[model samples]
Target chain A: MSARRRLSLGERLVIAAPYLWIGAFFLAPMLLIAKISVSQSVLARPPYRPIFEPSDSLAAIWAKAQTFSFDAYRALMSDTLYLESYLSSLTIAAVSTLIALIIAYPFALAMARAPERLRPMLIGLAAAPFWTSFLIRVYAWIALLKDDGLINNALMALGLISAPLQMFATTGAVVVGIVYSYLPFMLLPLYAALERQDPSLREAAADLGASPAQVFLRVTLPLSREGVIAGALLVFIPAVGEFVIPDLLGGSETLMIGRTLWNDFFSNHDWPAASAAAIALVAVLMIPLLLWERARLADEDDAR
Target chain B: MSAPLLSIKGVSKKFGAVVALEEVSLDVGAGEFFALLGPSGCGKTTLMRCIAGFESPDAGTISLSVVDLSGVPPYRRPVNMMFQSYALFPHLNVFENIAFGLRRQGGTRDAIDARVGELLAMTQLSAFGHRRIDELSGGQKQRVALARALAPRPKMLLLDEPLAALDRKLREETQFQLKEIQRLTQTSFVIVTHDQDEALALADRIAVMRAGRVEQVAGPMEIYDRPATRFVAGFVGETNFIEGRLDRNGAAALVAEFGRIPCEPGDLPDGARATLSVRPERIGVAREGEGIAGFVENFVFRGETTLLRVRVARDIVLRAAACHGERHAIGDSVRLNFPPGAGTLLAEET
Candidate 1:
């Protein structure tokens, strides 16, 4: 058969679509940032050295590219500000994801145990937050947590406190914003896992002389490991790079990597330095997640 | 005689307005392989659950070893159930699944391992100890479930449709195996099954249930030969029901279109309506003029026996089974006769 007739046009397009999407959207932008991270900054348009000029010869371009260095990475290493920002960002993400898991686990369990007729309504309510803008939801937390906002007013009205509490512009506020915004992300996968569990297993455990607490500890908790892994990773990965919540809800002292990268790019106008920081953040966040993913997949293979 | 091992009296349960069980009572002997046999929604499972303490009856007392089991939870009850679905823990391997009960009771690691190992060998799952539950086939999983429940060595074991998941050949094999295991363990077994053959083959005594009540409880042979009600006779096996009225002589016989059928003696006013149930295998077939003439309707050639439906009168067809190789074609005339006391007279159903 001729080359064109070997494979149909429709089949070829279907095979190529996913690769094309990843190439155009993910690989190209990542490659651009990587290239910029190794270049030097200069007082010029785009503010980076060793630009790929169409008019230059290959030899000339190669000679100019030799000037590119790892200076931005070196700066990040020497400065404690960036180091502290990375550590604090990781800490905040870990803590917030843990809190979200705690809140979502019981909610998902309740949803799974609910009557069949009421389950769809329960799921829709858990997912209802997605209908509105995420930013608006975070902003709503600001409204509730403000010193003179609804919470304070209610507490004072109840005569439970002598004065309004200082609630906003703190690390607590940032954590609250993340947990609220990502609650659905943590709950959905957990619900899926818990809902799929055959309740007969629990009954069987109880029949085998395990108490309720024992059954939960030995069976229910261990069986939902996949959902726990997925939810923790989902919340942790995005929270590490979260910029909007920290910027809007956190006080001036909050120095997560996202805010640091934003300041380096927009405020300091240092594109190469920001790129270097982003790369460092990704590398640091990926190692643990990849290890966990490998372990989960190995478990799945064994189970199958 | 000693007191019954498990005694359930006046047990009644309702889910909202529908009665799941009503005034059910039973006394299971020690080490007896008792079966609760019924169709779906017939209160057999509900009754089993009540004994297991997964559910509490609205009114009644279930005493294990003469000790009141009221207010006791399933975990606290000295009974373990092999669920209909098996319900093997997917996360735990066979060894751990069997060891779960031992571990919960807090024994030494070595002791738990030894008991689990013994059970694995007992169930013929010795090499599958480390395999995950999902890796095992359906029959293998059933063994694991049985092993797990038996590991606890409770005073009693409740099995709900334990062989329902197996294919026909496997079910027959497992039926004998289950009976053998029960004999070896010497534990009072309450097995719930809707398969009447399974009940007959495995149970020492079977409780036939229908519509939230027990119709009769008797040995398998007794149940087959003398079912207390028409429903029992119909449900347990195929039988020909000859509807007729009692003779005016106050004798225990039914006069139908075929003729007078002698039945076991029962109290009935003269001319009262009654029925006689004759098992197919009990009826003999021979040549024409030797007995009542019956034209063969059709025959089903089962491997060991051929079941022939013979019409003796208008609207009165009797089923008779001949051994394999006994050829009888449809529309052929044959003679059919049963012994004098082969049929059992059934009271008019309430």
Candidate 2:
């Protein structure tokens, strides 16, 4: 008789699939980027030097790796442009996430409280933006924000402005673009949290002599906190690394780390510097992301 | 009871085309434990919600101490409800959940703490005050809900199937605890439940409802022993319904398949069809010469009581609930008789 233990091949394969996918797709690329970030940039075949050649001996490879420099990262630190860009990207992302949250919360509440029959349609509408290409959507924002475009024209026609206001290529325009694109991300989780809430909680609050505003403040806001955090993270993470929206709709004066990275990689051909910037961006994002995950685990434990 | 503390008058409500409540009126005296009992979709819950001010009636007024409560919102109303689901705040600890109503009323910190501590003791959840709501058991959560609803010191407390979430044994235990709490608080309680046993056990008076109307309202014993309608009789407990015709005009007797049986007179004309509703316990095995003869068709042992079905003359079956020690096998010859005043004659439902 066989011993009554050990996983079967199929079970092992199923269990290992997600880890393998993350290892191959995420960790491997990250390691490669880290390796490239430490290498010297030169006008060469791969645009970077000191490749870990297959023919090199183990000792030779180790010795060559030791010769790797922190020049790219050091250059980024020495320049205030990178620092300002990082700060600006963080600020813009924070502002946009807050705005999206404020705007999306009421809409999410409305969707959650909508009649059951209409809920599916409301969700479909929230998700409808994903059907179109994100690039096309950002480009469409440009047409509306430009001085000669629809918004300014409408303002002029309605006698709201004279000599067409400077509407395009501004920080405000970039914020609008990011908010427009990420509003759905901010809305869906909130709707899920609110919708799953038992309506009786509100009634129970009211029954306890809490006025409408007090009920909202005491019960509704605190209960949907999980969704609020989830929605904020969803919007903030991508907004921090957003490239296309700022490139299309923002002015030259509005500096973002994404645009800086793009310039390093494409315009200056500084592959190592761009890789360093990417790593820095990842490091900046990791702290909050880890905190959020820990909070989620703690919440699950409390629920159990 | 003195003048009713809460009076609901001519309250009618409709949801689109469907009538949820129809001119429902009820009076709840101070410190009375009242129950709205019915099957699902019988408007018991709707009536409770109306009283709680969650749903407004389209056409009438609810008064507390003779003050009309027409436009008062739920938050402004002097009432609180323990929801069927408990609805304990998942984000708050037991202490905060119980203290929420007091905090909303803007009490001083010390007063809030004292009140919450007192409620925690009252609900027997003093140790659980520090525990998160999600960490509590179902029974503990129910106590938290009860404590939270009672913290505001409302004029009336409403419970929507407060014990519906518990298992049978726990439900029975909670029913007694709930009654004790109501007595101790001296606050009028209006509970809505579909469970007849719960209503019978916990309530001082029960309003049995059907399809958006109150069918009968009376004490438990009255509802059980002397139901007003055929619906109430069948709905509350097990009974043997014997259809019969009124033969003689005045003595209040029914001529059924078994034989002529004495019954309480109802609203029925001479020679009109009626039903003799006799509780299963009222019928007993009698001597052959004294009562109608029948054979025991089958019997079921129900722990405390043994139920037997007897096939009498004309193949008519009558159910009798006897004590467990009374042994009767299938096909055993038996005679059944109804004790005087044991059965009631109800007019045949149209």
Candidate 3:
């Protein structure tokens, strides 16, 4: 076991490969997007070309000189349709996250207090949706909410409603879809957090003379705040970028930034505008993203 | 004198097929510090929980003064428990933690503040009110737990292995503090502990338990001096049990035989099979020519005293304690003497 042999090339490569892969797939793509955001848009091309110049001296070079412009950002701000869609997406995401949290908290609490023999089964039930295709689940919601579908059919058959209800293609339908899709994401983390909490703390609160409501308010809620925050972040961040459910369940009344951005890139073939919108969305989410990252780091620190 | 402040009658609790407590009954007099001492599987904690209203007995009733606690929840019970973990709420500061009970009782802000302040001062924790529970030391947390439990001024306080978490020196010091607090408040306290020294030091009376049954319930000195059963005698302290049979009849002194000395049993029924229990400190080391002779097998030095294990016969070891500076080395021959009435005869287990 010589020192040089102990420091084997294969072991070092095995340790360094994960960082390399992360840099190539995640960091490199993000940097490339940043670079493309500043480039001139090409006309009638499937993929937009990057505008770069070798030198500034020659006439040809000057003709092809890449001009850095904030015009795309200016276009993004000026477009009222894009701005409203962005705001609507943010609102939908926030509202759905709140609703998901409201539903998940009690479910998580019940799961946490359930007996040991029943705990794994409940957790599996909460997580079972994630194992199936998300798209199919969202599509299933369309059948449940559409006119002459299950809900309307049952309502009419029971004489609860005189006619079929128009539920699909509304903002409410989009919210319902997003909440249903993302609810399990909120629940798992909340359950994990609540389950790890010591039951002794509640006993201590009771012994200290706290009523049941006071115990939940003072001890249970505060102790589970980290989990609540984490669950909210998990549900909100992805829902803000979600387009599938909104496109399927929502009618023309739903104009989320995700669907609009997709239409801008694929339908309109406006790469610069789409890239500009993506950059703006990133900028809009920067503060929360940073806070969430900080929270995650703090969680890691506490674990260590 | 007055009726017991807290009384438990025929308390029997079972968890499915396992019986945690079986017809257990005890009374805690006002201002008395009582202890339930037993090993891990014993019903000490179960009894404490039953009194704290965390457990309900299937065949008995618990009462405080004259109020029956049949359907009372823990929060409504006139008793509080200091859990073994010192289960402090990690989210609340010390002041809020101590004020928790008072707030629940619907006290006004000023009233809660005054009560919390008084309890803080009483527990010598006035300066620690702003500190987080995790920031405080173990002893500090213990004091905070004590103050929190005492804030409501319940009729009785239950402690579950209160001093088991402390180091030896701290445990001894806290034992005195606990006794003093109990005296000052004049509140009945039922402490559950497995440590015999803790039980003996802090208890006015101890209920020794074994396998969900009360083995003996008596004052500390009485329980120690005259343990009613072999298990009680062995569990409470170190003792040497010598097999013997009652030799005499009537009111005459009962005598039993050892290997050499015809050991006179202190006082027991004649013709009964018994085991004589003698504390190591009660046995005296005699000079080589004075008493029944034995070979010293080992001598363990314990700072203030030396314990000598003597071989009186094949496979028979007798223990005697000698004070420091009056030394006896291992491998030396020694004689053992039992002063009159120093031994207690325990009935043989069925």
**Model number with the top lDDT:** 1
Name the regions of candidate 3 deviating beyond 4 angstroms: A1-22, A35-42, A46-50, A53-66, A291-304, B250-268, B288-292
Model 2 chain B worst lDDT window (10 residues) = B284-293
How do these models rank on lDDT, best leading?
A: 1, 2, 3
Q: Please write out the lDDT profile of model 2 over residues A173-194, one tens digit for every residue.
A: 9999999999999999999999
Off by over 4 Å in 1: A1-9, A301-304, B248-252
lDDT of 2 by residue, B1-350 (tens): 56799898888889999998888888889989999999999898888888888888998888988888888888888889899899888888999999888888887999999999999998899888889987888999999999999998989999999999998888888888999999999999999999899899999999999888888889999999988888899999998889999876666688887788887666677788998889989987853657778888999999898898988876689998877677888998888888778887788887
In candidate 2, list every pair of residues with a backbone clash: none
* Better by lDDT, candidate 2 or 1: 1
Each model's TM-score? 0.96, 0.94, 0.91
Q: Which model is ahead, 1 or 3, in terms of DockQ? A: 1
RMSD of each: 2.5, 2.6, 3.8
Chain B superposition TM-score per model:
0.97, 0.96, 0.94
Candidate 1, residue A160: lDDT: 99
Candidate 3: tens digits of C-alpha lDDT, residues B1-350: 77888888998988898888998988888888999999998888988888887778898888889688888878888788888998888877899888888888887999999999998998899998988887898899999999989998988899999988888888888988999999989988899999998899999999999988999999999888888888898999889888766766543333434442344555656677778788888888865656657888998998888899988777789888887788787888888887766667777788
Q: What lDDT score belongs to each candidate, Candidate 1 first?
A: 0.90, 0.90, 0.85
* Top TM-score prediction, candidate number: 1
* Per-residue lDDT over A188-239 for candidate 1, one digit per residue giving the tens place of the 0 to 100 score: 9999999999998898888888899998899999989889989998999999
Pairs clashing in candidate 1?
none
